[model samples]
Target: MNRSHLGVLIRMVTWPKKVVFGAFLASVLTAILGILVPWVTKSMIDSFTSHIDVTKVFLLVGLFLINVILSGIAHYMISYLGEYTIYRLREKMWAHILRLPIDYFDNNSTGQTVSRLTDDVSTLNNFVSKKVPEFISQALLVVGSIVFLFVLDWKLTLALLVMAPILTVIIVPIGRRLYTVAGETQNEMAAFVGKLSNVLAEMRLVKSYSGEKKEYTRVMESGDSLFRLNLAVAKLQSIFSPLISGTIMLMVLVLLGYGGLRMADGSLTTGAFVAIIFYIIQAITPISSVASFFTEYKATSGATKRLYEIYSLSEEKVDELDEYTNIFDGQIRFHNVSFSYNKNSKVLQDISFTAQPNQITAIVGPSGAGKTTLFHLIERMYTFDNGSISCDQLQIDQIPLSNWRKMIGYVMQDSAIMNGTIRENILYGVDDADEESMVHYTKLANAHHFISSLPEGYDTVVGERGIKLSGGQKQRIAIARAFIMNPKILLLDEATANLDSESERFVQTALVNLMKNRTTLVIAHRLSTIRNADQIVFLDAGKVTGMGRHDELMNTHRKYADFVEGQNLKMAQ
Candidate 1:
C-alpha cells in the first residue's frame, strides 16, 4: 500500500481508538493462549507415562477450558468493534457524498456512486474488522510456534524453513493476478448495478415504447460481463488455495518421516515428537492466513482508491456574509455574464438583462438557445466564467448559497415531485409551514380542490415522482410548493407546456397568482402564454437579439414577428 492508503487506514482505525486497541490486546492474548496449549498437552502426555495425579489432571483440563473461554470473549469483542467502526465510516462517507457539487453528479452515475458507498465500503469494512485481527493473531502464532520448534530441535526447524520460499514463489504471482481480477469484478458489478437502476427508473418508458426485449437484452449482457469477471476471480482463488495447502502438507510429511528415524535412534522422545508436530501444524495455519491476507489487501487497495477519488473532489464553497441575509429585493441583473457546461463551447454568451421588481420577464428562445441554463446560473448550480449576476445590487456570489436559494422559488418543466403525502410534498423545504398556510397555498394553485376530493384528502400518498397525479395536478402541486415559499423571485420553466387546454387554464391562473408582487422569469414554449409578459427577451444561438414588451418586439423584430405569426397560424389550425 502507498502512503495515502496507509493514511486512510490509520484514520479509520483511530476513529474508535479505545475499542480497537482493546480488541487488538485481546487478540494478542488469545494467540498467546493458543501457543501455550501444545506445551501443556506435551507435559500431560509425559505425566501419563510416569504418574498422573488426579488434581494435576483436573488443573490441566481447567486451564484448557479457560483458554477456550477467553478466546471466545476476545473474538466477540473484535466483531463488535469492527461493526461499530464500519457504521461510523459509512455515515461520514454518505454525508460527504450528499454535499458534493451538482457537476459531480452530472459526470458520475448514481449506481456507481451507490456501489462505492455500499459494496466498496463493505469490502474495506470486512478487511478492517475481520482480517486485521486475524492477521495479527496469525502472525503472533507463527512466530511463537517457530520459537518453540527451535527449542525442541534446531535441525527440524531449519528443515521446515525450506518451505517458506517455495510458498512465496507460488503465492506471490497468483496473488497479483487475484488482485487484478478483483478490481475488474468490482468495476463490472458497479456497471451492472448502474444499468439496472436506469432500467427500473425508466420502466414506464420501456413498456410504452415496446422496448422490453431491447432492455432485457441490454441487462443480460451486463449480467454476463459481471458473471465472467467474478468467475475469473474464483478461478484464481481455486488455484491459490490448493497450491498453498498442498505445500504445507508436503512439509508435514517430510517432518513425520525425519522424526521417525530420530525416534528409532532414541534421540527424540515421544512427547517431544508430538509437540514438534503440533507446532509445525500451528505454523502452517498462519502461513495460510498470510496468503489470504495478501489477496484481501490487494482487493481492498482498489476499493480504497475509488473512495479517495471522491473524497479528493473540491466541495462548492459558500461564504457567510452578514450583509446578505435570506432576503432579496426582487431586482436581478445579469451584466455580460457568460458560461458553458464544458468550457470549450459557450451556452450563454455575454448575456445582459434586468428582471425588475414585481414584474414578469419572459425568456423566449429556440430549443438549444440556453433558456433553462439561465435558471441554473441564477441558482448557482453552475458558476459562470465572466461578468456577474446581482440581486438588489448585491453580487450573488457574496451571498451564502443556502440563503440565496431560500429567497427564490423554482417550478421546473417536468413539475418535479418527490414520493410523499400531498401535505409532505407541498411542505418539503418549508418545514415550518402551518396547516392554514398549506391549505391557502394549495387553494391558490388550484390543487386544494382535487386534494380534498381524494379519499385520503391531504394525507393521500403520491407514488414515485408523483406518478399517481396527472400532469396538471403535479404542476399545481408544484406551484403550491413554490407558493408556500412566498419567495421574492419566482422562476417558471415551461410551467404549462405539457397540460391540456383546460389544465393549462388552471395552471396558468395559479402561475399568475404565484407571480403577484414578485420578480418572475418565465421560459415559455407556447408563445401565447407570455403574450402579456412585461418584457420578452428574444434569444437565438446563445445571444439575446431583442428585449422589449411583446407587442413592441412583434412589430420591431422580424424573427420575433415570424415566431408570433407561426404560433398564431398553428393555433388557428
Candidate 2:
C-alpha cells in the first residue's frame, strides 16, 4: 500500500484514540484467555487420567467459566469501538462534503457522490467493525499459540515453521490480485450508480421521447459490466480460501504423522502431544483470519482513496470580517468585467452596467448573449476574470460570500422548490421569518389565495419540485420566497418565460409588487415585459451593443431595433 493509504488508516484508527486503545487492550486479554482454554482442557484430561479430585475439577471448571465471561465482555467492547469509529468518520466526511464549492457538483455526477457517501463509506465501516478487530485478536492468538507450541515441543514447532514460507508465497500473490480486482469492482459500481442516477432523474424526458427500450439497454449494459467485475473478484476469493486451507491441512498432516511416531517411542507425553496439536489447530484459525484481513484491507483502501479525493477538495472561501454594519444602498456596478467557464472561450467580455437603487434594469440579448452568465457573476456564483463588480462602492469579492448572498434574492426560470410544506419552503433560509411576514409576502406574490384554498392551507405539501402546483403557482411561490427575505437586490432570470398569458399577468403583477423598492435586474426575453424598465442594456456576442430607455434604443441602435422587430414578428405569428 502507498503511504497515503496507510496515513488514512492511521488517522481513522486514532480518531477515537481512547476507545481504540481500550478495544486493543480488550482484544489482547481475549486472545490470552483463548490460549489458556486449551491448556486448561489438557490439564483437566491429564488430571482425570490420574487421581480424580472434586475440588481440583471444580476449580478448573470455575476458571474456564471466568475466561469465557471475560472474553465475551472484551468482544463487546471491540464491536462498540469499531461502530463509534465509523460514526465519527462518516459525520466528519458529510460535514466537509456539504461545504464544498458549487463547481464541484458541476464536475461530478450526483450518483457518484451518493456512491461515495453510501457504498464507499460502507466498505470502510465493514473494515472497522469486522476486519480490524478480527485481525487484532487473531494476530495475538497466532503469536501466543506459536510461543506455547515452542515451549511444548520445539522440534514440532520447527516442522510447522518450514511451511510458513510456502503459505506466504501462495497467500501474498493471491492477496495482491484480489486487491487489484476489488478496486476495479468498486470503480465499476460507481459508474453503474452514476448511470442509474442520470436515468432516474431524467425519467420523464426518457418516457416522453419513447426511449424506454434505449434506457433499459443502457442500464442493463452498465449492470452487466459491474456484474463481470464482481465475478472476477469472486473467482479470486474462491481460489484464495481453498489454497490457504489446503496448506494448513498439509501442515496438520505432517505434524500428526511425526507426533504419532514420537508418542509411540515414548519421547513425548500424550498430554503434551494433544496440547501441541490443539495449539496448531488454534493457530490455523488466525492464519486464515489474517489472510481474510488482507483481502478486506485492499478493498477498503480503494474506497478510502476515493473518499480522500472529495475530502481534499477546496471549499468556497468565506473571509472573516467585522460585522457587515453598512446598510446596502442597492446600487450595483460592473466595470470592464470579463469571465469564461473555460480558458479558450469567453462567456462575457468587458461587460459594464449599473442598476441604481429602487429601479428596474432590464438586460436584453440573444440566446447566447451571456445574460444569465452576467447574473451568475453578480451573484458571485462564479468569480470574474478581470475588472470589478461592486455593490454600494464596496468590491463584492471583499464581502463574505454568505453575507453577500443573504442580502440578495434570486428567482430563476424553473422556480426551484424543495419537497416540503409551503411554509417550510418559503421560510427555508429565513429562520427568523414570522407567520405574519410569510402571509404578507405570499399575499403580495398573489400565491396566498390558491394556497389558502388548499385543504391544508399553508401547511400543504408541495410535491417534488412543486410538481403538484401550476407553473404560475410555483413561480409565484418563488417570488414569495424572495419577498420574505426582504432583500435590497432582486434577480429575476426570465421568470415569466414559461408561463401562459393569464399566468404571466398574475406573476408579473406579483413581481412588480415585489420589485416596488428593490434594485431589480431582469433578464427579459419578452420585449413587452421590459417596455417600462428604467433602462434596457442590450448585449450581443458577450459585448454591450447599446444601453438606454426603450424608445431611445428603438431609433438609435439598429441591433436593438432588429431584436424588437423579431420579437414583434414572433408575437404576430
Candidate 3:
C-alpha cells in the first residue's frame, strides 16, 4: 500500500487512537518493570553472602510479584483495546464499502471482496492487538537488557555482539521471503472464497444441471493451491526457528565458558555472574520475539495492502445541489447518443429517440438489439460517449445524477428484492409513504391480496432476495415498489417477461395504470406487450430501423410487421 492510502486508513481509525497508544505505552512500561526482577535477584544473592538481610530478600520477592501482576493487567488491557479497535474498523470499512460506486463491485469478485472484509481484516486485527504490543514490549526489553549487560561487563556484551550481524543477515532474507509467500497464500485464499460465493449463489442452477461434481472439483483445486502456498511459508519458518535457536545456544555456551574463567580470575563478581546468566536468558526472548515481530510485520503489511485496495476505491459522485430542483417534464431525448462498455465494440451507435411526455413508448427488436443498452443510457447507469441525453431541454450531464435518478421509477427484468418484511420492501424507495398511498399502489400492482393472505401479512419476512416468495409473488412486490416511487418517468425492461399468463395479465393491468400519467418506456421481446404503445421504435444493430405506432409500423415497417406476425403465430400454436 502507498503511504497516502495508509494515511487515509490511519485517519479513518484515529478516533480511538489514544486508547491504542496508551495500551502500547503501558505494555512497554510492563516490560521495563520485568527487567528489574533479575536485577533484584542478583542483589538478594549478594546481600545473602554478606549481611544475610531476610527483609530485603522478602521485599525483592514481593516486588517480583507486583511486577507480574502489573504486567498481566497491562497485557490484558492492551489486547482488549486492540480487539475493540478492529471491531470499530470493520464497521467503518463496511460503511465505506457501501458508499463506493457500482463499477467497483462490478469489476471485483464477490469472494475476493468478502475475503478482504473478513479474513484480511481479521489478520490486520491480530497485528494491531497482539503483535504490536509484543513488538513494543520486545523493543523495551531488548534495549533495557543490553544497557544493563554493558554495565555489568562490557567485554561479555561485546562477545554477544559478534553474533548480532550474522542474525541480522539471516533474518533479512527470510523475512522478505516469508512476506512474499504469505501474500501469495492470502491471494489464493481470496480467490477460493470468491469461487465458493459464485457457486453457492447459483446453487439451484448447479443442482438443476447436475454440476455438483464439477463445482466440488473447482473448490478442491483452489484448496490445493492454498495448501501449497501455505506449505511454502511453513517451510521457511521451519528453517528460521532452528537457525535462531542454534545461534542463541552457541552464544550461551561461549558466555558460560568465558564467565567461568572470569570468576576464577576474580575479574567478575559471583553475584554478577548470576545476573549475566539471567540477562542472557532475558536477551534471548527479545531476540527471538523481535525476529518474529519483523516476520509478522511483513505478513500484516500484506494484509494491509489488500485492505487498502478496498479503501482506495473511488466514491460515487453525489450532487451538491441544496434543493431538489432539477425539473423534468417527463420528456426524454437521446440526441446522437453513442456508447460502448469497452472501446473495441460499440453497444449503441448514434441512438436518437424522444419519448414524449406521458406517452407509452416501446422499444422492440431481436436479442442483442441494444434494447437494454438504450434503457441504461436513459437511466444514466452508463453515460454515452458522443452525444447528450436531455430532459426538459437541459443536458443530463449538467444535472446532479442524484436528482436525475429521483425523477425515474425503474423496474428490471429480474424481480430484485432483499431480505426484509413485505412492508419494508414496498416502502424501500419511498420511506415516507403513507399507509393509504402504500395500500393504493400495492392494490394497483395486484400484490395487496396475496400479501394480506400471508401469515404475517405485510410484515412477512421476504428471506434473502425474497427467496421465501414465489417468483410471481416477487414480481408483484417489485411492481408495487416501482408504483410507490411516484416518479415522473417509468422505465421497465421486460417487467412481464418472467410472469405466467395470469400474473402477467394482472401485472400488465397494474403497470398500464401506473404508466397513465407518467412518461413510460418499455423494452419488450414479445410484440403483444407493445402493440398498444403511443410510439414503437424498432432497434437493430444499435440503430433505430423503424419508428411509429402499432398500425403504422405494421403497414410501413417490414421488421416490426414480421416480429408481430411471428409472435402472433406462436400464440396461435
Candidate 1, 1-573: lDDT as tens digits: 352562474365335667667767877777777777777777777677878767656766876787687677777777777677778778777777877889999998998898888888888888877887678777888899999989988998899899889888887787777667766777777788888889888899999999999999998898998888888878888888899889989898889999999899999888788888889888987798887887888777765666767766787774443554855467999999999998999999999999998788999877799999999999999999999999989899888887788778998988888888999989988968999999988887778889999999999999998999998889888888988998888998977676678767776787776677789999976667667688889888889999998779878999988876765623721
Tens digits of per-residue lDDT for model 3 on 1-573?
453443455456645666667766777777777677778778878877768878767877887787778778778877877687788789889988877866677788989999988988888788778887677777777888888999999999999889998798889888888777777877888999999999998999999999999999999899999989888888888988999989999999989999999999999887889988888888876788788888887776665677888877776666654375756577888888888887788888888889998788898887788988888777776667898888888887677877777778888888789899999998886758899999999888888989999999999999888889998788788888888988888888877777788777888788777777688998866666676688988998888888988789878998878877876723621
User: Where does model 1 exceed 4 Å of error?
Assistant: 1-14, 53-56, 318-324, 498-513, 568-573
Clashing pairs in 2: none
lDDT of each: 0.82, 0.81, 0.81
lDDT at position 369, candidate 3: 82
Evaluated at residue 116, the lDDT of candidate 2 is 84
Per model, state how many residue pairs clash.
Answer: 0, 0, 1
lDDT of 2 by residue, 1-573 (tens): 362663564375445667667777777877887788777666766777777767756766776687677667767777887787778778877878877876788888989888888888788888887888788778888999999999888988999889888877877787777667766777777778998999888888998999899989988887998888788878888888898889888898989999999999999878788888878987986788887887777667765677777877887775543474444577999899999887679889999989998899999988899998898888888878899999989998887877788778998988799999998888888978989999988887778888999999999999877878888888888888988988889998877776678767777787777777789999887766668589899989999989999889988999998997887723621
Q: With candidate 3 superimposed using the best TM-score fit, by how many Å does residue 275's alpha carbon deviate from the native?
A: 2.6
Candidate 2 local lDDT, residue 177: 75
Question: What's the true lDDT of residue 4 in model 2?
Answer: 65
Pitting candidate 1 against candidate 3, the one with the higher TM-score is: 1
Better by TM-score, candidate 3 or 2: 2
